[model samples]
Target: MNKPNQETLDELKAIYVQKIKAEFPKQLKNFSDKNAKEHQLSQLRGYLHKLVGSGESFGYTDITHTARAAESIATSLMSESTKDKPSRLTYLVKLLEKLAGIVDKIEIESPVTLHSGANFTDRQSNAKLLTVGQAHIAKTERKHTICVWVIDDDESVAAQLSEQLLSFGFDVAYFLSCAAFKQALLSSQPHFVIADVRLEDNSDFYRCADLHRIDLKSFGLIIMSAFDDFHARIKAVRSGAITYLQKPINVARVASFIHEHKNKIQLHPERILIIDDDTDLSALYKSQLEAAGMAVHNLSDPRKVMAAIQEYQPDLVLIDLYMPDFSGMELAAVIRQFDNFTSLPIVYISSETDNQRQSKAIATGGADEFITKPVSADILITALRTRVKRARQLNALISKDSLTGLLKHSAIKEAVKSEIARTSRDRQSLCISMLDIDRFKRVNDTYGHAVGDTVIESLANLLTQRVRQTDHVGRYGGEEFMLVMPGCDAESAQVILDDIRERFSNIEFTVGNKGFHCTVSAGFVQLEASVFLPTADSLVEHADSALYEAKNTGRNRVVQSITARI
Candidate 1:
């Protein structure tokens, strides 16, 4: 787990310290009245519990320990079984007095201490821009250089895996032992490590331990073994292996897994919505999450939550359990009522320490998790990242085409609509390309549907590989595909699509002992906000018409839309 900026964190901590100083004494004074003590003890306990959580999170060890002790006493007094209430009350007051003294002694560091680490916010923003053609080609070119290191005692296994990864555009290095890998780590770091479980020295289980001791940062570990024993699997999990593969590996599967994992981890930004009545606390959270590269929106008013969700379209919702108008559970229930947000992740962040209340909130509101306040920044980021990644995966399953893994027809149309709106606002150029496999039905009739399916998949792969990451590709219908390229002018798009047409024609398809080549015909419509008012339907219709002309003129060629030609 990574942390946000140290200076911002220090500022937030200082604010929290001042907050404790201003509020604790007033809260503790309520305990002095015997009649009010019974009524106010619960409130006091809640306050102290908050201190205990936030203090530890902000590195205030003394405050956390003291508050924990005072909270325990308060909880005991509230219970019906407590008999020596006066004695416990006296002890609680002394602890509270000690806490006040500790707060007075606390000093915030003035000068900032900067830590050199990757900027999460920049990475997230780049991911969003990648979808809109804002990031340049260099970024995509750099992705080709992802380094993967393989450690296997078997020379043949290492060589085979390394060669496969290299063919997939990964930089690959292989070593026979952990020692060699460790030695290589002195110079450069690899993005991923594929290690064998059975090392020559039988120190396989300690490989991950060695990496941890050396403090390796930001790399994935994969463990492979010939033995599928339960103990081996357990050790792999204990060693923090991200994935485990058995012997007789599918090289293609490994390559696909790496590509999928890399794209999923690197390309998505976490969108978070925070609803809390305490404006200061919400601001602190907003700053922290944003600094960590998440797009965050915070609201002090729960009444506007639905509208915010609609506009922001968050990946996860973080709600404070106690609010002025509606509790976190109540808001979650309202969100769950809508079918669109039913599967959205809703997490409760609060200082309430009662186990029963937390459980009740989760069950009643259909919340995913109940996170107690005072969570470390690293833990918070990691937890939210895991949830967001899972949610995105689920979304892809629902919206992506099964065969080609591109957006489905409806999803891509919706994407075009959204992109068109964005282009209109930004005053940018957008291109929509419609592609059809030439004589695709004839091929199915001659070679069978399976071969035709292969042709479609091949074209999908080619288009996806050739296009920019910011572009969207979809299976529009049988034998047809659609591409939405933002910030791309007509001339550039024409050349790119022509290049794809040439490449697709060169790919040889085989059926039994026969081998043949297939060609694709494509037509594209480019829209400049200054020249034309582009709607999604018109873009699709014009592109399709151009595609129809291309098919009529020549079976394999790229054509610009007639509307754009004029």
Candidate 2:
């Protein structure tokens, strides 16, 4: 099955869920009627069966299972005489209510598809809503929200800290001792940690060392020392504290730090690939694209187009229409042969102004948009941005893992191919990592699909947070993720995979009241141009083989491809 991107999956899921919810209650109510029960059970069964068939495609396995169970119960109730089995009818109604609750709780993670109405055009209305909502969220979330940990032994200092932080819309957590602060750090994961240099029994020595071990470099840490001596200040700096405050604490400086770093801390920039045979043209396009603040790759050789694309797995592509030996039309045609590249945007740019020539360019393959040269800088930039944005939207429609916000299996394959192609042409190293959630099926079977989805979402978030900005990470079907790392060799990629494996192994998940931990097994293949010339299928297969080795050897570790070593 082709996997849709997050936006596409969310839209589809929302529509499917809304449709089921709207229709099911009416169907259930009709079923309870004296004459309606005779005919309604068949309709209910049919609807539930349809949902079961389609739900997994949208990453709504929980909804699928519920529908399946409801279908079974409805079937059983229908078999019994209604007059003799009133309890059976009640059970069916209760099941329908439960299904309704599940549907209600399902969040609509993407924009809804607009429907036309007689009054206002639905598309226009939805566009307006999206614009407003986006602006609002961007404004709201961009504001600095400081989170501080107060590790003061005094009860009054701890209590006052919370009130002071709260006045400025900051979140504050108090810890009475070093041990209490350490325990709070494990669960709360606050943005900043503040501690007194002098703790009870001089335990600050070990406590400061422990905090440093947790990689608090990115976070703000201030040591409050009552002693004004230079020795105490030096001790605080050596212990890995950012700043040492002498007795008096400045709330203003702390606020300033939060404000300065708030926007600085963000997810990595998205990687983009540009394929054009003209070196001058590629550079020109790359400059404009880079100015827009996107990571861009430019390739001038059509022969290595696929290799470059696979290595970068770019979010979008801008291909020149005419090349020396192979035209952009021919290259796009070749790309279309691969299933992963079917929906990828391959925009053609050329000086060919004839209408017939433009039509011919598009006719060669799946050309999304065309640009006639000499391309205007602003016009070209707008066109590329629009194509990239649309690609993301289309991917959301068809290639998103609804719960995880990652690329669906088919999308991930396409992205990997594009990345590999880019890396190969650029002679940059590239890596592909296949990650499998260990004992995932067991989790699903034991705690139901709802809990399983939470686990998947959490893992996806962690992978996204850990990977480099240039890396491509996506959901490679059920309980598995695929990562494409450009400019990374086998050793560096292994280090990254191992770090992710360790972090994921320690993450604890709780569903209702039951807490459980899960681990991931990874197989990664890092390829240099000298070593395995980049092809999408070859790279993916190599990585998959390594992943198989990791799983066979034992879960929760990373294995590199032996083929690459050879």
lDDT (Cα, 0-100) at 197 in candidate 1:
79
Candidate with the greatest lDDT versus the true structure: 1
Clashes of 2: 33
Q: What is the Cα-based lDDT of residue 16 in candidate 2?
A: 59
Angstrom error at residue 228, model 1: 22
Candidate 1 C-alpha error for residue 157, in Å: 19
| lDDT for position 196 in model 2 | 74
Clashes of each: 2, 33
Clashing pairs in 1: 53-374, 130-470
